[model samples]
Target: MPKKYLFYISQNYSFAILRPLQAEIQRRGGDVKWYLEPNVNASYLATDEEQLTTVEAVQVFNPFAVFVPGNVVPSFIPGIKVTVFHGFDAGKLDWKGKNTHFRVRGCFDLHCSYGKDMTKQFDALAETYKTFKVVDTGWPALDPLFTTDTALNPYISNKDNRPTVLFCSTFSPRFSCAPHIFDAIKKLSESGKWRWLVQFHPKMGADIVNKYKQLESENLTFIETDNVIPLLKSADVMLCDTSSVLLMFLLQRKPVVTFKGNQQGEHLINVSSPEQIESALIDALKQPDELMQHIDDYIKYIHAYTDGNSSARVLDAVDNFTFDSLKTKPLNLLRQLKLRKKLGYWKLS
Candidate 1:
């Protein structure tokens, strides 16, 4: 018999990345299911019986090792579960194990870190975990963006994002933060110089939307929450600070503007002044060949996997790696030993 598995994500947003893995799992004769845990907010880490499975319940799934997003290893299903970081760097998924307020303890396994260099933010997470793997499975979200159609992407649902501008967070102070880059956008909106779409983090529901409402710009519509890919497509140009969402936009290779706060601050795009910001935006608006040259590298990073069929490649890697351990005990001691070492821990002593 094949292994039966229950796949879980903290929110609906992760579906794009997880779905391909899901299809791959099922293709291999493993049973797969999605666990939607409501009330699982960014502000809190307590897993609810309904919102998130209790530690005991996760154990019952008997997953042949689980694939989890980020490093906040939840105590639930502690025996199993690996981290599949859904972003470009390790900082994007910080589960210190000390911050119980943010993680359920053992909620992570191995993670990708978007193929980013592991020496910086990634080193600590690998040191802390007893078992973890870093594969170039690519950002789960990017898998769908490259493999699927624009119609499948939400921003272009209508086949057009007439004036969409996504408020992708910098994730600096916390998991995600609104960068000052958007202040420039608010200015144009207030003046009715341009119509835009400000999509905040799905986890940051209500708070940022309320702030947008306070801004009260009629030309700009504040989208509280929607899958960002579609909004990314709908917009002619994306204004953002240093973020991976810019990678997504490059998949479309659509015009993009880097948000440079001021001369004093740091940004992924080296925004030293309002002048540079205007220069970048103006050039992007004009469709300059100079800016077009960078799009090639952006696409390379966006599609880290060699093929657009990354879902298949990731699944193949997992399938070839998957074993019949489920037929024996819930886990193989050998595998468990390896897993323990992978997480940089002794087997629960």
Candidate 2:
């Protein structure tokens, strides 16, 4: 009998994160189903995909494992809970000034971590908690970036043969460069010296999104899409502020220019003022050897798995996990209650 798996998701972005894993599972003859939270749009599911609509439906499926891209998963679900994570840690801190990326929520049996730094952190956390295990499986969302052919990339249509720059930003008002750099970008876009592609986080303010949309011209395009791999592939350089998407871009071994980025490194060309945007882009497009080397060293520490087989590694980790040996997870009563109420499931079993 084939093993059964469940994908538990609360946000639309999880679709992109989990689809690669789903493909690997099906390739191995394992059965997979998705359980989307009510807040998530069901229309995002592909026509061939299957969804388990209710708590009862999920119970009936009784999957061998439940994969979650978000922080929490309902413990009542019949499976060994695994966390694949949603994004690369951009070193953002919580309101309390603690790194939230490594926070242990007591909800998962295994954490499929990416890169060497993250694995080391989680390995220490596992030693401290003794309730869960850690596995360095890289990130499945980036598999297509390495596996797909550049000729088939949909975002590379530059008829003018101008150097392309992709601009992206986080939605947080505190960290977003969108509001502050609008005038600089508008001026640059109108100059028609470079082709511009602007994409923002889905939660970005509509007013800010509209302003960029109005700037669209023969040289500028506003992109609205869930998958950013193509945008990363198409752009000669990326400009952003504090968004984890920049990490994804850097993995392409390209240069990135940031505006007041949360983390400063040799891998990035970080600027504090709008007046410096054009200069930074010019430098990034040149791809200086020192900057490119720094990016390569950073990639080794973060994610060295450029083989595009992270999904396969994730499945292998699941297959080899010793679930029975782990210590009992804490009874997080408040969080469990919130999930139960949110899902409207009252059954104790």
lDDT of each: 0.51, 0.93
Report how far residue 153 has shifted in candidate 2, in Å.
Answer: 2.3
TM-score of each: 0.67, 0.97
Q: State the lDDT of candidate 2 residue by residue for 1-349, as single tens digits.
A: 9999999999877898899899999999999999999888888899989999999999999999999999999989999899999899988898999988999999999999999999999999999999999999999999998998889777788366899999999999988999999999999999999999999998899999998999999889999876788889999999999999999999999999999999988999999999999999999999999999999999998999999999999999999998676899999999999999999999897
Question: By lDDT, who's the top model here?
Answer: 2
Give per-candidate clash totals.
Answer: 31, 0
- Best-matching candidate per TM-score: 2
Candidate 1: tens digits of C-alpha lDDT, residues 290-348: 56666655555435463455555555445455323222222345554544444334524
Full-model lDDT, candidate 1: 0.51
